[model samples]
Target: MSEASNPVVEGSLRERAARRLPSHTFSDLLVPVSSALDLAEGHAAGHAQRVTYIATSLGIALGLDAPTQLACNYAGLMHDIGVVPAGAGLGAYTRGDERMVFASLPLLSPEEAAVGASDSPEIVIERIVDHVIHGARTAREFGLPAETIKGISAHHEHWDGTGYPHGLKGEDIPILGRIICLADHIESMIDQAGPLLGRRNLPLWLNQLSGIEADPNLVSVLRDLASGDQFWLGLFSADLPGEISLGCSRLREPKGMRLLGFSESLSQLVDSRFSFTVGVSARVARYSEALGRAVSLPDLRLKQLRIAALLHDLGQVSVSERIMAKPGILSVEELEVLRNHPAYSRDVVAGIYGLEEVADWVAAHHERMDGRGYPDGRAGNEIPFEARILAVADAYVAMTSDRPHRPRADDADAQQRLRGAAGSQLDGDLVEIFLRQVVS
Candidate 1:
């Protein structure tokens, strides 16, 4: 099927490309982005959603006010936002060693995994600290409330003061953090065991961890909630995303340029996974915006294009750092794995309410005018105009930036490549405008 005619590409360009598009609150956008983080961590699809639901439910049970409850929800969704950069620093470890480090740390008891331990232990501890600090900073950049920031920063802190990031004991940890900490662990447990088995063991597990890994009082609240079957059922429900949206319905939605800031922050997280690709998304967004304007795209279309550009590689998180950072050419198997990122990006973006069209554009950004591109091979007019412009912009930025396999191209050389690939690999018209209006 042609790209435009694909059943997945709903709404006309005129409707989807309106100047403002549909308004989406922070919850609407971040909920889907949270799934992308789940993919990065090798967790189940709804890990963040389940955590959010559990945390928000606990906050309500604890009688937290609306703002605090909202903070709990937001913290749950983004608690691990720092994991990408934290894992990025583990470049010295082989893929197996990296897995061992992450897998082993979780099994450590609070006292055994203290932050300043020697040798390999210290590396994991420091990375934990880096993760929380970076996550908190990203939350602040998104304009989330201070409570939400604190919750994200301190979620690892145990009640006994043994956690890596801060070692806060008892009531010292932010209440939101305590709630998220309990919820995060519980979700992980449930994920490891299916909900049915997880439900049977949850109470015993909570009692054991009380006053050690979790706040004892929060543990009591969770026990009370877990007594009812509905809690467990809702947690593992197929529609957990819907439940999360309902739970956070009260939080105020961020509007206007704030959305831009959120997208940029997410882009940074995606880029942080590899050293060579650090700011590639931001540059792609800029180039795409310039090309959009050059082609007289409406302001709304420009906004969508910029967001798609920023998030075009959201699926890159699913690729391992070992593969992404490989200095040599990839084998056929590795190349196939890398090529799936666009489809991954599309799935994540499509989950957001107002970004359906943006998702389609992102999916098609790698497509070729002559139908040689992947994930979908729509040629010529079958490709969305925005995707075509994005193709040229992405190509130009990628050519000019260093990659794992190649040094960056000089401007003249990069422009020549663009000229050579025009019509075959990229839209010819968009490529010319990019070279003249953007590069010049």
Candidate 2:
């Protein structure tokens, strides 16, 4: 579907997000999202956080202004945002496999090479480059600073002009991109090696690829920063997110609506992971808002509900595409893994400030009034009222939307299914309100 006609891209939700973005810090808003992105790529927690720390520190040490430093910080957090959509074309390669392929680009392990043996090198490079291209587009759509978008676009470009998508050489790469490139590599090293060993070897590693892989000037700045034991200690600290936020205190905060757009953009990215599920979150949010208004929920409560609806499936990123796209019933183990996503969603959202209540509602989206949910078995009013509304909206959208395993139910059939499940699999009143008011 054309983006302009897509319900998710409609302006009403963007207005709502705009209205809510001003009160929170940009870091507070994006750190949870960074964690979610990490989950999508199958990386351990804190990769983005560490990258943000390293890139921002390098920006500051290099005498960048506050705005540039903030861009560096955000670009670091969201550099790989394209990976979700890019994974769609990478056949049979798990997110972990994709990561390995990208990390060892222009070189592949025997197994990695075997997976794509039939594909030409140009095709593989194009697929790998797709992530950065989509990432830059997403960053722009979210109304990020121009420099931030450019940095994301060029983060993978090598100084020697061998990168994919575009191979601009030397100073052709944005400085912020150069800093992030170095930071991204350094963070990977730290993740592969323990912090102590990573720190010890960083100087040698930087010297070996100083001009080929990254900007030599940025490498020198990082080398100087690495000399201080305190830098490594701070980066590996348990409260790395907090430290990054504190360090960024002097930078300008993003306006409220931009942060909201960022959240909406992320929800779209999550939905893009599977073709059948495209726009599911947006539809759910639309229905949930309609239901919330019908119930006369307070404005603040409605806003919270909207945000939760957009992000309710944030944990779905943890599920493998193979399982999600399975044309038949999932095995019991696979089903269990699928069922655990809400808990993963909760853990990721709870890390964001002021979203604790939203996190709880998101976690309970699958709970039935009859206590049949997998993650939690709260029945009757035990489930949060907001979550009950979310459940009805989710059920309606899922039924009406096509899935790999089933055709889309017609409106009449979907309504009947909602009515049938009312009071058992779903809250009866919310279902009635949804069908009678919202659906009508």
Candidate 3:
């Protein structure tokens, strides 16, 4: 174990560690990330995947090439991504009613504006319009082609210039956008369907929407496609992610920094799940990875820590907006939902292949050394070392960030609180390394 004697052996070990690390592709991350988005609405499980299938199917029917079809699918999968950051006040966007449609008239209520500066209709609409724009930006950031970005951003644009953002009309709308907009509309209608109004009224609904919401030509195609049993069967199919993969020939497999970049983008989306937690995960990722490096963790473990930190708060998507945005202390009942977020994060990450170790770290990010933490309370060494690093990183970032409940802690105060919790709450040695080396 002598330092001089171990140099060669340690270098070899690091090389092996680097080689042994697994690279996650875009599909692996996108599937679960989209699943996280779907969890924001209790009734909307698999919503994105279903829409992808429908939209892509229409893309094929419309004679789009393979790349364009894949763009349609990508747009369908990511159409709601803007919901993460603006989740609190996006009820108007999700309703799919005429009243909620984008128009020039004042949409904000006096009461809604009183909630917070960010809750105003003007702000929410800006955010809602920005959803499509944000989706396009995210698609581009993830290395999706320009077609994908255009399709996703224009998915809300209408034929008569009644849509959002650019308000393109008729042929001015991108074909990919038109297809996804129709698919999105159909999906919403089906989601709202129930005992009173079943699938039988779907045609009537389409008929009602022909000239206003979309092009009459596109509506005719959808109407024709709706008559086929195969469309319905495909719409409700269980293997949506698989189906999308089969259609998307251009999705490159992301590795190394590219993979990490995707995780960072996803972290931003996860932060969007609640307005208060914006940028929280990205900061944790930076701090945790830095601390992991400072502690001389293996290359593979550092990568795991970075990914875990990026997605640590993913479970919060399942919690209600009211609970997430509550300015006061959480009710005992609300705390129950909030407490399950870590477990939810664990489960979401675990479902994706090659990230089992990262999932464990994400699940344990809230666990305390003294066993007073949430989801699971394993104390001390029972928690993984990387999880301990995440705990410290998460604590420091959360404390330093401004929240609705309280003002942000200044650097000096945040350090004192983090230092005070070294042994019983966080790993004492990691905290010291973080304090002395990383942040300092």
Model 3, 1-440: lDDT tens digits are 88647988889877886756465555566666677767764435677787788787777778887666656766777776655554454643333221132211112222243233333446455665665676676677778768877887787787778887798988889888888787877777776675235368878988877887777887888788878788877777777776666556354433443666777877776676555677888889999989988888877778878889998888887876666766799999999889999998887788677788889989998889999988888899999888999999999998999887899999899999999999999999988999999888
Put the candidates in TM-score order, highest first: 1, 2, 3
lDDT of 2 by residue, 192-291 (tens): 8887788789988899768987899888888888899888887888988877777667665654544456567878888987778889999999999999
lDDT per model, in order?
0.81, 0.81, 0.74
Clashing residue pairs, candidate 2?
18-257, 21-256, 22-256
Give the residue spans of candidate 1 off by over 4 A.
Answer: 1-18, 95-121, 251-257
Residue 73 in candidate 3, Cα distance off native in Å:
1.1
Query: How far is 191's C-alpha from truth in model 3 (Å)?
Result: 1.1
> In candidate 1, how many Å is residue 16 off?
15
lDDT of 1 by residue, 157-225 (tens): 888988758779899998988888888888877777787789889988898789898999999999999
RMSD of each: 6.5, 7.5, 6.5
Worst 10 residues of 3 by lDDT: 97-106
Model 3, residue pairs in steric clash: 84-272, 84-273, 85-272
Best by TM-score: 1
TM-score of each: 0.89, 0.88, 0.80
